[model samples]
Target: MALELIKGNTAVAEAAMRAGLVSYFGYPITPQTELLEHLSARMPELGRAFVQAESELGAINMVYGAACTGLRTMTSSSSPGVSLMQEGISYISGTELPAVIVDVVRGGPGLGNIAPSQADYTQIVHGGGHGEYHLIVLAPASVQEAVDLTGMAFDLAEKYRMVVCLLLDGFLGQMMEPVVMPDFQPVRTTPPEWAVGSPDSKERVVLTSINIDPPNQEQFNVKMMTRWEEVEKNEVRYKGYYLDDAEYVVIGYGTAGRIALTAVRAAREQGHKIGLLRPISLSPFPTRAVDELADRVKGFLVVEMSNGQMLDDVVSIAARRVPVDFYGRMGGMVPYPDEIANAIIEMIQGEHDVNADGRAKWLAKMRELVGTGE
Candidate 1:
């Protein structure tokens, strides 16, 4: 295939199609509607299934149904829309179905702006739905990354018989980048042994999330835990830059991470020995790598488009070994590279106190930036 300039959502849609996606069920939501629009025309042309459901709730249930046949299936939505699909997401998890979800996150406590925000980090990565189930979540920082991860999302979902999500903020979804997409994969003609409606199995196959018997539910829960352990062992992924010898580290994911790259590079050029750790797999987070960095680095700075959500996660990993500071822009606001650059300079120069209140300190900086000098 040739490299083509593609928008993030279109690239993801096309990548999923070529990855042998058997069905795609989703609703139209900003930053991700392009994905559905592209699949609507492409899926049917390839003789695959494509349904734009009435709502996010309706779409997720449709994905659940398609996945029951052991088919490669998926759905995409923005932040608020994904929230609406929570119930269906939990049901799919309880059923242990392999289905893909694409979340092009927008800003929100409620119907926030159409602009990009990484606030969904905790939502998708931490399993917002009501359940003990775990999702295989991938965060992408570019259109190309989104394309690659979308393909992987399906395989990861099927590989573990668990839900997988491509979690990119609205910025990545709308951005355009050049990418050489992969060729089409072989289609699945037969259902898995556990799936319903398999002709090869003469015996009846019943696929259901309903475990009316408490013991049965408990058994399945234990099985999920074992499978999640496998995921943690095998699926952790991240990208590091300039970390071979660094006094401080900056951590972010998706758009925030992409922007942080600029800040980190600019800081390095100005003689600051800093690096970045961008986690590709948000869930099953790169904990070991983080633990190692905390042991070596003088301090750490966590940046995000949300109000220090992932900061808490990194703080937990650091365990007070070194100071971990936070800088963020929330409610669809994105931080400038210079602002993050300035934050990095501050962290490296300030008292590297182990118990410093980074969020409170960052909040003060934000207040000054937004506050009028009256």
Candidate 2:
């Protein structure tokens, strides 16, 4: 197929359409409004359902409703908007409904800004909503990756009967790149037996998060945890770059991962044995891979657009086997390749402490570089 230059948001919308998305409900939010706009025109043209919801809450519930009927349903939002949908997301997860949610993350704490940021890492990966539930979070680093992962999100959501999240930075969502779109896959015409509208179903299908009996709720929670374990074992995905002779590894995801790659290459050219580990799935975070690399690498440098949210995960997996350091640019700011390369060099050469002191030092340096006062 010929590649077309498309914005990340448009690519995801197009990919979902081709992947047989039957229903879409979303509210317009910066860095991801294009996705909703694209689907509004495309879905109805294809005779599928599309709704510009009253709000994020309305949108997520609409997704929940569509998904209950065993339809391919999705919603997109930025950080603040996603916050509004958390309750609905939790309900969907508790009910074991399959759905896709795209979070084109921007700067955040509260309506932080519409610019690019990776601040939503903890919210999306760690439960954004209340419950003992896990979301299958796929972090795509590029426009093409966004397209591919969006399709994969739908398939995985159905296969596991869980919510799948496509987490991307706002930069990726707004930027344009060449993407080879996937071929159209046939939509599921026959609903599953558990679906609300299954044909000739004598029993009424009830989907709800409520479990009045304590024992039954405990049992349901156990089942959810068991399924999460399965996902962790089978679904962890990551890409290793120049890891063979690497003495130092840089870990990141989404747009930050892509930038880290450039830094890795630059450091390699400067005769440093630097490598990169990019986590594709944030939920089932490639902990095993990091553990394996910990034995070989001297230390780790975690790069992120947020204030080291994912760095916490890296530190847990590395387990102080090798020192884990961090450099971050929060509030929608992006770090440059040279900045990352320099950090890699510093991590390798400096005999830094692998504790809170080390993190403080690194953060101080980052603040200095970004001209933020202590």
**Clash count in backbone of candidate 2:** 0
Report the C-alpha displacement of residue 194, candidate 1, in angstroms. Answer: 1.2
TM-scores for all candidates: the values are 0.97, 0.97
Model 1 residue pairs with clashes: none
Residues 72-123 of candidate 1 have per-residue lDDT tens digits of 9999999999999989999999988999999999998898889999898888
Q: Could you tell me which 10 consecutive residues in candidate 1 have the lowest summed lDDT?
A: 365-374
Model 2 — which ten-residue stretch has the worst lDDT? Answer: 352-361
Cα lDDT tens digits, model 2, 1-374, are 89899999999999999999999999999989999999999999999899999999999999999989988999999999999999999999999999999999999788799889999989889988997899999999999989989889999999899999999889999999998999999987667889998994679998899999999999999999999999998999989999899898999998999998999998899899888999999999999999999998889999999988898898888877888988888899999888888788888888855554446777777666667654
